[model samples]
Target: MSAREEVLARLRAALAGAPPVVPAPGPVPRRQGDRPPGRPELVELLRQRLVDYRAEVHRAAGADVAGTVAAILAAAGARTLVVPAGLPADWRPGTVEVVVDEDLPAARLAGLDAVLTAAAVAVAETGTIVLDAGADQGRRALSLLPDLHVCVVRPAQVVGIVPEALDRLTPGRPLTWISGPSATSDIELSRVEGVHGPRRLHVVLTDG
Candidate 1:
């Protein structure tokens, strides 16, 4: 027999007693209470995971969000800031020049010192922050081109697992999942940061 035929014959013999495969009809329904309720521990776990990924983490009361944002920008020495159209006005630091994004060109975006945005949801288990291009989050380029990214996450927006995060998101909107500052290693294992995206990530978690 030809080599291809011989191989096929042997595979059929090996599976002679194997059960027929069945495909799932749809996504399995999650059990009730499978999703953990929001708690202080979830926030703490998120903080630990974010720090482990080398992201700067800060906590702030709801009323102090603007001040916390301003402080972070000042410490980073950010002279110019880019923000989405729907970003809260108070969050824009008075110390720096703020530019609201209006489909800014890539060149203009690259020259900015930092970008501030509100996250749609965050996964504590994986230390991932997601952006859904909502009014508070501009197009993907806003987050991708800047050197520094400061994202604010509310306690209610943080989830314990990926599935929970997914359930909270809409399928049609463009989503950006960020774990940490962008980095990659070279052939000799030398680490490089900011090669693909922002080199610095600062997460501000706000208490409700």
Candidate 2:
């Protein structure tokens, strides 16, 4: 018999007496609450880790985010700012040359100094901003191409852990998890930013 035929015969013989292959049921993993114990000062821990992730985190009360954001953008010498469609009007000021998303050309996006938006969730442990491509945040390109990014996250939207944030995010669809500015290390150990995404990422935690 040919090699294929021999293999088939062996497979048939091996399975001939074997019980129908059945998947063994395993115990399901319990949720976070059922796991081991660890108590932490979430706010402080989150801030500490965010620093480690190379992200700049600013904390302010909810209402003050707009002013703080405006100041930050201005300080960066940013002239053109891209605002999402559904973003709250007060999240940014009226004076700035606000650029809205509406089939913006490559030249406009390239010239934009910063792109600002509200995040779906922020993982404090990893300094990650979750964007669901929602109206408040445009397609993945808007945030990725900009030189600087200003993401406004609410206190309640900030999770103390990564798994918690994963639970909050949906599995399907275009999800962008930004830890910090795009960076890479060369063989010589030289570091580069703005290679694939933003060179600087500034986060504003607005108390929800």
lDDT by residue (69-188, candidate 1, tens digit) is 889999998889999999877677777889999999999999999999999999888899999999998999999898999999988888888888888999999999999899788747
Each model's lDDT comes to 0.89, 0.76
Residue lDDT tens for model 2, 33-87 = 2222122345555567766767777886778877888788888888778987788
Each candidate's TM vs. the true structure?
A: 0.82, 0.78
The parts of candidate 1 lying over 4 Å away from their true place are 1-37, 186-192
Badly placed stretches (over 4 Å) of model 2 are: 1-40, 189-192
> Lowest-lDDT window of 10 residues in candidate 1?
30-39
In candidate 1, which residue pairs get closer than 3 Å at backbone N, Cα or C atoms, i.e. clash?
A: none
**In model 2, what is the error at residue 43, expressed in angstroms?**
3.4
**Candidate 2: C-alpha lDDT:** 0.76
